[model samples]
Target: MTVKNGRRWSTANAYLRPAMKRPNLTVVTHALVHKVLLEGKTAAGIRYERKGNVQEVRAKREVILCAGSVGSPHLLQLSGIGSKAVLEEAGIDLQHELPGVGENLQDHLEFYFQFKCKQPITLNGKLNWFSKGLIGARWLLDRKGLGATNHFESCGFIRSKAGVEWPDLQYHFLPAAMRYDGRSAFDGHGFQVHIGHNKPKSRGWIRAKSASPSDNPEIQFNYLEHEADREGFRDCVRLTREIINQPAFDPFRGDEIQPGNGVVTDAEIDAFVRSAVESAYHPSCSCRMGSDDLAVVDPETRVRGIARLRVVDSSIFPTIPNGNLNSPTIMVAEKAADIIRGKGALSPSDAVVGMDENWLERQRSGSPERVAM
Candidate 1:
């Protein structure tokens, strides 16, 4: 939840805003980079198209590629730096052979478990245009209202079953029952819990469809292709039901609105999951960093066989983390900046993380003794 002053705190606002006045910095808008101009195996500069005019910009020292998970691979393939077979199939001359350029694509998939609310204390009541306008007005005036927050104030992480080393499932609680596109399923008050398996064994790829820069790349996540992922979603449905049925929710909980009360069998759960699951938009690990034959980037984030070029984004992650990639991607950029400046590695922190003492015996610890207010 990277937010500040009631607005999303993005990298552009934090890092690029103050540096816009620097003499050495230049920012281009509405331009599409067509490809990286190469001299043999070294990156010399880039070719771009802006308003139908093609242009080239030469690099003084080196070129750093930060086009992100989808763009990075697509741009690399367009520049003839990817799997030999893939480039040949796309009718592009091969400049370098990196078989892992667009391989090992991964993402998190989730679904909202919605429930009808017996009480009127839910955001669904404020779905009208008048209520939304008022909320927006309040936030614009002082940044102190329902619109100030994303409405996902509560979250939790827990293991799906035994033998798991850490929490594999993540939860985000919302007080409104609506689709991701803002469409309400019913006309009554409701709530939902966004639950998903954080770690999945499924893998997929992204490939260039053609040599044209304007052509969209082909992406296939192949989610739930593994038996463990299917089992994990079944655990998600059952475990979410257990949490929602607690005594604390008895006063407000009504009938189940999603997947319904009749969807109880294993086959039914699988069918529901297959139809209901949506992408969490955490695509990563396409250009993995390592020393293996399939590795596209090396330990220093540089392209394995290419000189004066590097990748600095989530695509360089050797493996996806258990949580969102936002913070980790920021950390990667900061570390890459330091490395590029020839700075020494920062000392590792000795912070101790808390864990359940009985974690080996149970999936989760018992509820703490609640004290009345």
Candidate 2:
């Protein structure tokens, strides 16, 4: 429940900075988990590799796997707790059959809508060595500088269309035109929005290339495969155009750089999305949580058909939240920590935000009481 002004923080800047100083915690580095040591149907310990040699460590309680969406499932598969077909193909003996282990993989697809700016007030000016030195010097002198923030000055979440339950599309507005990876788009002044759908219906999977833990998994996101996903992206482009087209940007807005003026009509937009859309890189749910037949982990985060083994990461997210993975992932880890400690789940929060039924019509005007008096 930490809050600082209006900005959100990352693990390294928030949690781990103080955590690394704690005397009770032991940090292990460069160790690769070979497999979970299983005694019958129960997870007994861990077999890992370090310095080109295998090592074993017995777990006193349960073996928690927090290797994230891809790594978690890969470990489960290597330890013989995944789809029989995948495990068999990977040269591993099958011990459990969970067809959903590496399935239901989800990630947001994003593209920057770059618009040239008439004014020179953008990050492009700061790219030079002189400006970079000034920014660095300011930060060195005091903790305040341009480097303090990611520079995503503003953001928004909105529904793709009517009848959508909640906001599915997310927008991260950057004052400078650049890729999410920090790749420069132009030398002149410009701005962009890192916008995309959060709850994409498109699905894919992760498969271990072989039995070796070091090998990269075969990943196929199948992005924009479904009609809804494609349509959602189309809405993203249209809606963004509408936002930047507003009177406020008339002074700053210049030419459209991506999907340019020619990229109109459904077909052209579709093609542009296919060409320009990039992974928001929020991979999750390769080991989905549920009690159904395909569920890899149950609601309690325990791997089905295995005792003393649990996965506590984005891999077990029942549904990808309508946002980035950072906050939701941290919340997941916190709740999982409680569950691991055998504590009763905390009572649910009662706070709720009431949504307006006619929000689309009055979106610009925040008039009328949102909830009952």
Winner by lDDT: 1
* RMSD, candidate 2, Å: 3.5
lDDT at position 89, candidate 1: 88
How well does candidate 1 match the true structure in TM-score terms?
Answer: 0.96
Candidate 2: give the clashing pairs. none
Q: lDDT per model, in order?
A: 0.91, 0.85
List TM-scores for all candidates, in order: 0.96, 0.92
Could you tell me which 10 consecutive residues in candidate 2 have the lowest summed lDDT?
Answer: 364-373
**Backbone clashes under 3 angstroms, per model:** 0, 0
Please report, as a residue range, the 10-residue window in candidate 1 with the lowest summed lDDT: 364-373
Candidate 2 TM-score versus the reference: 0.92
Q: lDDT tens string, model 1, 148-167?
A: 88888899888988667789
Per-prediction RMSD in angstroms?
2.3, 3.5
